[model samples]
Target: MEEKMNSGLVTSSRKKLTIVDTDVHHGYRAQSDLYPYLTKFNAERFAEWGFGGLSTHLYTSSGGLHGQRVDFDAGEAGDGLGTIGDAHYCSTRLLDANGIDLAVLTGGIAGAASALPDVDYGSALCRAFNDHSMEHWIAKDPRFRLNLDINSQDPLGAAAEIDRLGSHPAVCGVMFSCGAPKPFGQRFYHPIYEACARHGLAVTMHFGSEGEGVNPPPSAAGFPSYYIESRQLRPPAYAVHLASFIFEGVFEKFPTLKVAMVESGFAWVAPLIWKMDLDWKGLRRHTPWVKRLPSEYLVDHFRFGTQPLDEPADPEAIKHIINWIGGSRTLMFASDFPHWDADDPMMTLSDQPEDLRRRIFAENAIETYKLSLPAISQAA
Candidate 1:
């Protein structure tokens, strides 16, 4: 039997399956594109001080097309070339072409602006980007869902934004863009998490913002010089955030809150969970509020994206790692679309069992994001 997905892609199967991509990126064509969304004050400030409201210099590093795929066309035609492109490119190359049921739009500006020293300006930029994303990306396709880009610097403002757009039928989660001044589990961020739980929105902490503006160094040893070196530091950053959330008791406060670590590899998760369980056995006295083991919260409330999928020398080792991490329930397929390192859905985790593959590609996301089949299918 043939079952048609909400995205209008039909699959030869009795049961309808959804391919929920958790980490698709949609960026603006230019800084000027946000001008209309910005307030009069922020617009003038942007003209004078640029992005950070202090310096025009952005985090510079050597990488081909800023790590985007070389073959990705920016919809260039004649004189109308040199644009930054938008979600349509993703729809063309990834979503539509790959039979993706739903893809989450994780915008760049919201995360980038989170590092700015000026909290008010950073919050404004996040709001502007959310508006821009709603108008340009989410409104264009039902297959796409929004991860509300928020500024962690202003928790109150972040919560307010969540309240404003949290109920939007197209919105599924909230994104912090990683690079926050403090660990997400701290008291400072509880308000944001509280707002997310209220809206039944998952929280996605994507990789970015480290060592830029007011954000701390990427790793404990301080900043690394090369892009490769910086990429190597992402896992540890995720580990720290996970530890903070577990130890600080964020889960106990908002039991329904779900957290997804996007663009952060999953190989380190098994070890981190094992080690935390070992330490918690003895250290449980200090953080008594954490009634269960640390790993329990992780397996219950946490999820990991499968992009930049850990490629060890032994290909079979990937299977072993996935088994150790609790199978498809803990992993979601993320393509990091339009980026140079995007994974091809047909190729990712091909060796996994059919059941596991279905969960990673679709089932896990449906449960985590609390999405309905009819809603997802109708969007397509």
Candidate 2:
């Protein structure tokens, strides 16, 4: 689908601000596109088992479109599907059309790879996906950056993958889908974080894999009957991970580490931070290693993507939330492109002050991802 923004809405001082989309999902037009990247052993194994796209089960609530925008041409379903054509179609349709300066490609490998029971197989799948993305997506467009997916089941392998690809000029960060075997801050995953810090790359945790494959149920109360219910679980899931990262002193261990919570809305963040600060005041003795209030770490080391921007009846409420969360620095723009719920850059958060809008749209992302911007023709 072609996504164009209303040019008037994005102009700041009569200049269209460059946009940095932190969470664009570049999908495989077909499963077979990855075969050439997969090892001979794994390729044969996949053939026997049948290709499992990113998720283990179909998103029953996607209403047959699987959460993709109905207008998106997924190309035909045959050999050489996405590889043959439309591979860079999204880049032209969305980024170029909308004046996006840089987009981080969060591919669909993390969930499926993390869900595999065989750790070796999961690692192999991750490697293949990274290789495929490098050749087909990042190499095709200098504007597209990568968030290399890793298999959390094998942290060593995940770290090795990061070390191997972290230096690529277009690789910006490391990504893990929300559903993992354990909380991200656990010692088991420290090596992954260590590698990210070493490479000066940020870590992005996107919402995916909940209740699918080997992931536990979507919510603590148990699985919900409808998709809306599952959607509600996303914020809390991010909250849990954030709390885990804070209380466990992950930030203290790697002070330079930056974490971006993609697709999870930011409205709930202020309240959660307030509560954490309140409890920490009384419970500081338990986790003495945490040097400051929980919220302080978040402000310094974490960023929230602004895709599912909260829409309150009063527009002022959105501004209030942004201020409470530390202004423009705490949020970054993410299109979640090609997905059914993707936000329009010109439309989402349009009411914010121009300075804040510019920061969210570009500056915050560049700083968070440590991006080196390339020259592009300015929007007239």
RMSD of each: 4.0, 3.5
For all candidates in order, the CA lDDT equals: 0.78, 0.79
Which residue pairs show collisions in model 2? none
Residue-level lDDT of model 2, residues 330-352, one tens digit each, is: 89998877666778887878877
Listed per model in order, the count of residue pairs whose N, CA or C atoms clash below 3 Å is 5, 0
- Put down candidate 1 lDDT per residue, 101-197, tens digits, no spaces: 7888765566567788788898888888889889988887778888888888889999999999999988899887667788888999888988998
Compared with the true structure, model 2 gives a TM-score of 0.91
TM-scores of the candidates are: 0.90, 0.91
What lDDT score goes with residue 69 in model 2?
61
